[model samples]
Target chain A: MRMPKLTAFLMATAVFASALVASADEVHVLNWKGYGADEPWAIAAFEKATGNKVVNDFFNSEQEMLTKLRTNPGLYDVVMINAAFNDQAMAEKLIQPIDVSKIPNYADISADKAGSPMLARDGKVYGVPWVWGLTALAINEKAFETPPTSIAEMWNEAHKGRVTIRDDAVEAVQFGAIATGQNINDIKDMEAVKAKLTSLMPQIKTFWSSENDWNQMVASNQIDIGTYWSGSADRAKTHFKLPVSLVIPREGAVAWLDAFSIPVGAKNVAGAEAFINTMIDPKFYVEWVTKVGAPVSANAKAVAALPEDAFNRKVMGDPGVAKRIQFQAPISDAQREAYLALWQELKVNVK
Target chain B: MAGQVATGARSGLRSALPLLVPAYLWLTVAIFMPLSAMVFFSFMTELPLSGKAWSFTLDNYATFFAQGLYRTLLLASLKLGLEVTLWCVVIGYPAAYVLAKVFRGRSREAIFLLVILPFWSNGLVRIFSWAMVLREGGILDTALNAVLPFKINIDLMYSYPAVIIGLVHSYVPYMVLTCYLTLQAIDDSLIEAGRSLGASRLQMLKRVIIPLSMPGLVAGAALIFVPVVGSFMEPRILGGRTGTFYGTIIEDQFVAVFNWPLGAALSFILLAVVLVILALASPVLKRAA
Candidate 1:
């Protein structure tokens, strides 16, 4: 009994010393929902690859993420935000720049977009590209006998009571601006946005906050057609037997990209960079896209490496479609305020 | 004799002090401090000349009231609240009675549990589940087309009805519990006496139960009405872009607009409006009393 006790004590001491010597790291990643699969397998793979724990948090809107950060700084280590808000965050010293030399996997991003003037500002690097796509109106094939082709057709009387719109202020106003031949970048007054929404509101069945609304609308055939992200069509198609088409309006569409940025006061900067690089790794990149069920910003190598069927999915059809999708730059503060004020009025007065 | 009476009074005061301390502390810590901060901040604005630091301003209030949009939302929110409260009362009263009176013991508990089962999950989860059911390819349509070979455009995901239904579902459990406690506490003899007087079933329920349950009903109504007026999630989630309630306006000022002053001023205005409503309703409540 004494000999057995001594052996057990020695084993316990050895294990304790090993644990003390083991390197441990944690990376706090903030992004949208469906980015990380809330499964043990996914987390374990990430942890095993780079001895770090990733803490995932989700935000509903670009405003929501920035609102929390502005109200309280240093709360998040890394936050995924839009290009428009990131400018504000950088100006406020709320977030820091990613060291370009540290991110070798960024080279894997497509050649066409590698040097695009859209990603940088004032010779400094800020945002890393996340989502690459155009906003298109998703047509519910079952709801309409003849699918609405022209952007103006969404306002047609035939689909009056059974149409839905998203709650985004910029998309609705920008899309309407395009149709009206108004320069979207140069809108001054709130009146124009209100005018656009007031016209659009009468025909809308509802306004959706999330992509779930689009998925449900197309699947259920409740609203005939709706403005949605290109990725939404792909998700809707998987769930619904109906052939959902991306209607790129002649008027033009609001392009969007979500990006990852480290906060200026990030404690685990090295670990955060490591996690980002790992995410861009080909196998992990494919897994995230496959599981996420969305389009990607990864260059040809990553896309080429994907399984044949997954790679050839209709979501990423033409590379040129991406260029047509404009990015949201930092609009003047006055214009941003005008847009929001107009959006609020449209909410109340819309019949 | 004077000293004896004074000591007795002091002891009485001392004994009651512990019980009341918590209530005061609860309100002070949870409600008063935060509200005071918000009130303070409402007057505070970032003056560009002074940099990012907040400065005193009434521009927030001026902006809120100057526009008709802000006030309109308050009215819409109140309307939505009142409408939902009425539905909750109508639906909750019978459901509570069936669980409390018709069903007894474990079965009663089971029925009550079933009503509360959604609460155990999450309000958001249930709303999304409804979205799945009511959407074009939702379970309802799937089940419907299976039975009847037909198609219909019944997308109920992002309309006014969605918010209403979601709000009522979230609050109906509270209504049921309040009504249940009120009904259960009633003297059976009063009900029996009504029956003895040769009153019909509906008459006894109308005369005895409703009047007796009025206090709980009134309290529950007030509880639901106040929060329902401030409901932000339901409008954003269910109403989508198709429809909106007043909560969205409040959210706009603070989040999207970054106009905290205006949001706070608008909130105060809304408070006054609700108080006015409750004040006006007091007469009806007194009559019920």
Candidate 2:
């Protein structure tokens, strides 16, 4: 009376392999941190809708992901790279020109979400936007009598030995320049950036390397304020039950997007398109953002269906917020070397 | 004494040349070849590709000298290496002595097996196991928190002290094994003869037992100190980004920083430091023997 589980298993295995060996039934994907890990709803829906298994690999940085895709010709079906890297990936013939006709759910995504740097390029859609966020000043209201307003306030004498700066070169250098009203994009102006940083360095209790770090410093009032990503700031608030306000500074901010695109060598074109379509579903998008604490740019109606407070608190919801922020593009290889060299110099020269 | 040692050494070498040649060849191919490549790259601003060598430049050398990071990190590693060696020497000597002297047959094997338990486990896992014990809100913290009336939670992970502790824990077994071998090699009759001479318990240990153990102590110190100086992980995990030793910067330059030439130059600088330490240590070893 019992159906054979082994038969079902064999069928599933055949389908999975054909997706890899053949080109139609499996979606080979690459995405960055916190984006591609097992999301049960997305996986189930994608499989059911398209009869495709979503085979995914994760990359930590845009540099690594882009480099891998560039060096390897046709290994991946779909790769999620930032808008900045799309130029190189195109120039190198690393990515396939995405066929929007293959992906139908692309129509459902609104104008605002599609306009993200990673998804839209030169009047053509290359990818779909996933996570868009800004690095900001996280203020612990419980620690301070009055929380500071902007990035500059974090380095004020009152916050001495209580402010934590991120160890990231881009965030530290950009926030330093932006807080002081300098062009954050100009890497050549090291003296101006260094001057601002050297002044602020002493005020910083410690430089944080990982997002998981600085929780104790902020929560326990050892550090009253710090440079933090929105997800981290929100989690700190939720975990410690502290009134942590994630503040985007007056002097511009940094915005980044993780996007998915098919690589040139992709074996499973149909499956990849199916997976991308599955990700765009309003119901799936709503569940992902709510669970993951990252507001992915998706269907507005789906996002609106969430609780009012949760929707409002979603950092990605503010249009003006994104406008003020600059997204990083892969600088020319020469400039990248220069930036790293300069960063090394900065680390040595500063405390 | 020098002449005697030289002749004796020559005889020993002649006898062991067949065994020594294979080891020497292995060391050259495995270690020296890579080392020479690094040294060569240190002098080059850019690496040779397609059988073409880049123009030799000392920018890496200059960076090493100018930034003075090499010096600071080199000095930090040296200080930590010495501390780690001292820790192993202090802890391992007595433990090794107990294993060799007090325990015998099956009991000795069990105790020695206990010492080797950590060795059987992966080095990273062992260090992490210690991290689990020592880190804040970890095993030790929970235990202390339960017993202590106040916040006596010792924030052990991401501290220099924790690294020193981890280094000591990770490599102490090597020190124990080295010392135990030397202790075992000592004839039991010599210890008896010292006792028979009516030397005090302390005198017997100092005059007879300790002199024989000097070689083990020195060997153990070398094993612990040299590798610990070049260690990257223990310090990085334990220190966090608050700061790190010299090794971390060197690693970042190669892997993440993507400046192999600079990293190579730093490697040579570290190698020089190692050579200097070994040169300094040679005299102490000679005197001990």
**Model 1 TM-score (2 dp):** 0.77
Q: Candidate 2 lDDT, tens digit per residue, A185-296? A: 6655667777777777667555676755567555434567888877667666655566677888767776665566788878777777767766666666657656665544
Q: Give the C-alpha miss distance for residue B91 in model 1, angstroms.
A: 4.9
Worst 10 residues of 1 chain B by lDDT: B46-55
Candidate 1 lDDT, A1-351, residue by residue in tens: 012222432453353344332122666666777664234567788788778787665665565566445543444566777766777777777788778678778877765454444446677667666556667787877766766667787887888867677666667777767666566666555466567668878788777767766665555556777788776676566544456766776566776656667877677787777766665666765766666555655455667776666523343645555545555556765676776777666766663
Q: Count the backbone clashes (under 3 Å) in each candidate.
A: 15, 2
The CAPRI-style docking tier of model 2 reads incorrect
Go through the candidates in order and give each one's C-alpha lDDT. Answer: 0.69, 0.69
Best by DockQ: 1
lDDT of 1 by residue, B184-257 (tens): 88888898889989999989888888998888798889889988998887777777664565666766666565
